[model samples]
Target: MSGFPLPPNATIGIVGGGQLGRMSAMAAARLGYRCHVLTPEADSPAGQVSAAVTLGGFTDPATLRRFAEAVDVISFEFENVSAEGLDLLASIRPVRPAPSVLRISQDRIDEKTFLNAAGVATAPWRSVETMAELEAAVAVLGLPSVLKTTRLGYDGKGQAMLRSAEDLAPAFERLQPKPLILEGFVDFAQEISVVIARGADGSMAAFDTVENRHANHILDLTLAPARIPGAADEMAQAIARRVAEALDLVGLLAVEMFLDAQGRVLANEIAPRPHNSGHWTIDACPASQFEMHVRAVAGLPLPPATRHADAVMKNLIGPEGMALWPAAVAEPGLIPHLYGKTEALPGRKMGHVTRLFPRGALPGDLGVEAALGPLLSPLLSPLGVIA
Candidate 1:
């Protein structure tokens, strides 16, 4: 805040070294800035591209001190970073989507509470600290609910569905030492998400809403410029704007919402950093979410979030997704991005493929309905082409 503006070439310190960091580093390089990656993995995806790599535990003060000293500003790829780690780094440089916001986003129970206090509607949920609390939660929320740990869970891990009275014990049995939250089942018609970038100057810009389809609790495909009435689309963006303003959030934030059986939007969760749902921006938008995050953290003014083309982003999960890699790479209008990960295990995000289209193409006009008619046809027919 002291300096009026940080110039390009100022180094950015990025926490976590997954694909998000990798993409963010690439974006930083494009803007004439360098990235310093801090993670324990020597061969981390982000580390490979960053100007500097600090290999150590997230809680290691010495490593964090060295990392903070090396960069002009800091940001993170994930929400689960240690609060202390961020506090240490923030003392040295500005950390966008600041540690205070990170704390609320990192825990499900706190996140839900914060959202509710902000007057955002969410699925009814209760905190569970003990078996008694879990039982009581189930009693109030009823059977057929989801029990999730308060922290460090992603991709359906650390979450269990309690379909009946008999399922409660098992759900609690599987949960680790962390606290938990049990959410009442929501009969959602569809899921949608909004991604936005808030600059340090308090100005905000957002991309179009996206219709998301998930498989086994993992995001599968995201259709950009979600087919909805203009009013409903505005409603979604308004919700995102409210959430961003509530957090006084900086950098990219993804707000996941559920369209209930009644077609009403309800908040599902908040992701403080860039999200998989916004992956299409890399291919479809002039300034992608990754670039926006870097620009915001570096104290640069946010760029226009414009979509040059409508796009479909599909995630490649597990072995089946890996097998389709070669074919995905061969498609003319498809952009294939593979995370530098070996051994594709079940439910792991191996990579993604984005299909770009001309602007304003309808679902049928752009071949979306044809391609997604069966949903799983891409795996069946190969190259995502209909047989």
Candidate 2:
């Protein structure tokens, strides 16, 4: 083994046993590493696939120590894993991306501050701690702004739109008792994300930019090689790289950005693990994001993140997604991945499907729609699928 490599038979500890952990465990197994999953829930999606599982709360010191002792290194699939838990485990075993990364990502104020300090531009925003401060923020940012909790918000939860003065009190009332952030909304042309992986040796690889679409605040579809002009595509990747380097990141980082009307890219959020937008890489790229993450954390050499095919990734959310499973399996060129969640609750991500086409083919390519018609016609008719 090399000086940095975690030898083949070593165990990798994973925090947050969700679908991302499940997929990361699968990739680690392929590279000859065993995975031990830690989560509070029994029979977690990741636990089902891992070699060992410890069921306990993240903040429990005993649980953290026991888990740390069993694994050669630790990595988390979700950002919400307790920072205190990671700090305890780090004394026993290495945690890639580090606990500091978690602290920065878990709070909106810290995240925006870090981004701006790194010389990345973000939407105009103000920190609001009380109703009076919120009112003051509104006077400056004006109506049509977004009010979100400073921490623990995702997928549109903990967020409210303030479209008019009349909406302020109700919005404040709904999001009160917790710190808040009011952001002046950006009138953007499209949303895109760049998923990049950085190795322990500082080697980095970035996948093709992905265009994202959302429905009811949930990720709906992702099209690889987002149809922006070449310059804008390069700019997005550069911004992602800068953020990763600034964070001193040693694992995967996903930078979500908005392309404004003038074609400027503004950082919106950063996820310090394998991300939903990069799902297309599983079918279209030389190395999937999950595998790249494993390689980075295990000290294995990074692979070139190159796309060989045009791809479209669609989320299977709720009952609507579950209903398409039968057809999804039978469709040619479609790769279906179910998260193994027993309950298909509304807004929950049950699975995803990726369809690949020839390189250079756009969504509007003649045969793309015809090929995906059967599997997507029902769920995507209203929202429309981007190529």
In order, the Cα lDDT scores of the candidates are 0.84, 0.87
Clash count, one per candidate: 0, 1
Tell me, by lDDT, which candidate is best.
2
Work out candidate 2's RMSD over C-alphas. 2.2
Question: Which segments of model 1 are wrong by more than 4 Å?
Answer: 1-4, 362-366, 369-387
lDDT measured at residue 167 in model 1 versus the true structure, 0 to 100: 87
**Candidate that scores best on TM-score:** 2
How close to the true structure is residue 291 of candidate 1, measured as C-alpha lDDT? 88
lDDT of 2: 0.87
Model 1: residue 90 alpha-carbon error in angstroms = 1.2
